[model samples]
Target: MNRIWIPMAAAMIALIGAAQASAHESLWIEAEHLDGVRGYCWPMGRPKMKTTAGHWGLSGPGWAAEWNMGGESGFLSIATGADDDKAVATKTLEIPTAGRYFVWVRYGDWREQTERFQIQIQQAGGQPWTARYGERAIVEEDNEMKLYWDWVFAWDRHEVELQKGPARLSLASTTKERSPRQVDVIVLTTDPSYRPRIKERPGNHAWEILQSYRDGIPDGLEPLAKNRPNFNLPSQWKVRTFRNKDFLYLWNVSHTKPEETWLGDKPDRVKVPYNIIDKETREEFEKTYGGRDDVPIFSDPRIVPTFHGVGAGIFTTDPKTGELLEAGKRFAAWLDADPNRNWAMMMNYHPGKPIGEKGIQAFRKYRDRFVGSISGESLGYFYPDAKAMQQATA
Candidate 1:
């Protein structure tokens, strides 16, 4: 079993405390499993080599490949200038493991915003295959969408398996002059279909929205003239109702950045779907959701979204201190309202950051804390426990 499961499991015990659990087994995929995947990138680059098994870099012709897995950003990034005028270079290698992986590919269109990318992978020494993924329906690109270069900064995942060891991984590209257009980060896992879940939301109403984005919004909801509203206020936010279904999932919409850039609106800063539910709905949601134990609390206010709406249940800040106010009643009320719940846990701050300093405990509404689990979480901005976040803060 992937060791990542330990952290996730710990967080799970911390989240629902002891009753609920996520359907997914692992959080990421194994890099070794990605070998032999067929790939076709647009006009500028090709697959290369990795100095190490988990390390990937440009290998076809030049020494100017930008890699990011262990770089400052800890993401995959690439630089151009590897291909000479004669003919584009092509690089290929055998992947080590076999499992689902996330392939992040981007093209810089600064000079030429027009480019198409073809990426694929396959069993090493076997016919290559391109993993297909579902794109969100309503994509509103932001200013950053124009592209700076090929970035491996994306963590959006796809379902694939690397059963055949020594997989052959290749990235081939053709570009306009000296442009770099590919960078990638590979996360592996045992389950080919494992996808992470989001934090909060109201109902399945968000599902229709996500499905529409993945496929295309249903005709009924499509704007008359093709205008669609963007709601990222929460982050790459998504919403869903679950089995115990106590809380509505507010997941992040991963590809909401440029190509389909939003004329006006910050990607990280988005508006919540306030119109979806109202006060009555909250009461009903609590009634229907019953009670659930397991929502680990965080004392850090940053752990909680600062902005709150009528339907956007949020913690209140101390008018005098300016620091987030403590509020345990809100969560307690939330749990009390739900019939299936019983356990209470300590607050789960965003991994590190002091709990009482700014977490749910900062507010009177979330005072009654419960068991805490700050490790193995990917909620919000992929926070690691205090131990993990310590370096980031440093």
Candidate 2:
């Protein structure tokens, strides 16, 4: 009985040891850590020698650097000249007891340009298998200027099969000329669905709503068309309702830049000068009205028109029934009363045409009537200023 028990215990120990060995064989190779075969270097163009730990190598003619951003230790970036050159990084990893392994690559395209590259793996007694990667959807980076990098980990499961002992894993960018591709790291995992921990951008609800609108209309609404009038609004315009407390507001957020541009082309059309005021004029205006009874008004007309409306208006409605409330009627009446007031103000201070005393007074009055905080339930209209409305008609 003792002899039998000893043999059984030995067998269990051997199985546990094999499991540990298998786990140890998995690889996590950093691109910058690979052996630099021919021409890879650090940030200052310093030469990096080949080693078992890994190094970077570049062939042809280009520059490379170590970029540490988005919580990565240091990713290799071929900053420039890769368009006419090739960059490659290679490493030798040993597989203790390999069967099938999923491959995951961590990389980034700072420029949002789809960069293409290939991963070649040569097993002990097998031909090299090259898996191409790139043309991935551009992931929004916190910093889009390329001053900082936002790394994305894209993976292909069970894509690589390895044998026991040493295997040469390499990433080569030797195809068509283009911008340099960012390489962070490559991971091999027995778990097919394994994903490395990395920071991800927060989701925006407004974007989600916009995406939903693009995908399909909500229930009970008319099928959306680029040209459809609703509730006396012109074609290509509609009211979007929003509620706050007891009041519902009608908002028409439409694109009017094209129409505005066309209106500018007409000889008789009144063009509202936007961002035409030079810095010098703004400074003079501030100095002249530094502490006068009149409020100093210096704003980017282009932004102002866009912010207010091409025919943008907000009016109040009965929250429960969606019927126009008294406040809503009043708001509409105000819009109709002097439809040209807003646009006239915009055009008064056209570029090279300084704001006269009359223009200043008119702007003050316009501000008092149009711009105010909305509290509780209220009605409003985002109608285009009189000029835009006229242009639309013309």
Candidate 3:
């Protein structure tokens, strides 16, 4: 009876060990940790990489917050700038006791911009299998579109089968020259019910390494820390809402220098669906989109008229002469001459230099047209004499 009891107890211990091993079958592959093969970009170039402390609810050392603008930390960026450009990131995934592993990749799908990507897996002596994804409708919640990183399962084409060894896993872009798509991490799990939560899971070696790298930074090479946006403005001025009559802003339309090419012709720079037109280019623009009301420029709910912001030296003194540029005067006349040009034209300024008494007086003539200096949102901080400048505009 004692021998039988001892054997039963040993069997119970073996069963518990098997259960524990099966419970920990999931393996996390950090996207940034993967080896970049081609057309891959470092996180240092984008605010998402520089600002996010730790993505997916994971944070530790090396996770220094630069601007705290909110984005993923240690994420991989796949560039898509040219027709022939292709981005690929690969890593060897270790399978503990793999039979069939579900591959999950976390990525940002802001406005369905990052909808084209592929997840490929290859086991030893086996041909590679690709699970392709394509454009998906934007997921919306609470009357707003979602723009955060979410997980997608690689199960469209085939189930990923792996042996209990190393398997080559890759993420590749399938778009023809566009914005970069960011990938945060990948998870390979044998448990059918396992789904990644919002926070970081245990056993993230890449996260650990990032912390160590941050801890080892020398004295002055550290990145400059920046405070987040100040949302503490007055209640009425807190939110700037766009009205129906508001137009999309465009600058440098009045550059008289022939050497400075006009950016209005560039589709990338002038991203509106309608071709920009004024008194000079009206006939040319009307030839294409004049009769079509269904075109995006007319049909899109978010479309607005283009606001031409003409730059003049008086808004900020001329670099050499400290006098109002003749070109600025000409643009103001051009904008005023045509009764049809009432769609929001303004004077653009640099404001990096002090607007002397002369410049300030010149600005008073058309103060209503000036929309804070081209420094944009930092006008309060970057623009010298904020109160004086505001009073002049007011």
Best by TM-score: 3
Best-to-worst ranking by lDDT: 3, 2, 1
Model 2's lDDT to the true fold? 0.46
Candidate 2 lDDT over residue span 106-127, tens digit each: 6555445565777888986689
Task: List RMSD in Å for every model shown.
Answer: 23.0, 22.9, 18.6
Task: Please say which candidate is ahead in TM-score: 2 or 3.
Answer: 3
Q: Which 10 consecutive residues of model 2 have the lowest summed lDDT?
A: 344-353
Candidate 3 lDDT over 1-394, as tens digits, reads 9999999999999999877654646777776677753333322245343222112122111122211223343433232322222556678877788587777665544443445667898887889888865445323422132422222212122357788888888777656424344456677776665655432454434565577677686555655656556667878765553332355443333333311221123332222224433646644544555444554443453432233233324344565786655544443454355423322233333233454555567666655544433432123223447899889999
Query: Best to worst by TM-score, what's the order?
Result: 3, 2, 1
Task: Name the better of 1 and 3 by TM-score.
Answer: 3
* Candidate 3 Cα outliers beyond 4 Å, as residue runs: 1-22, 37-70, 73-79, 82-85, 112-114, 138-143, 147-158, 177-179, 202-394
Clashes of each: 100, 27, 1
Best by lDDT: 3
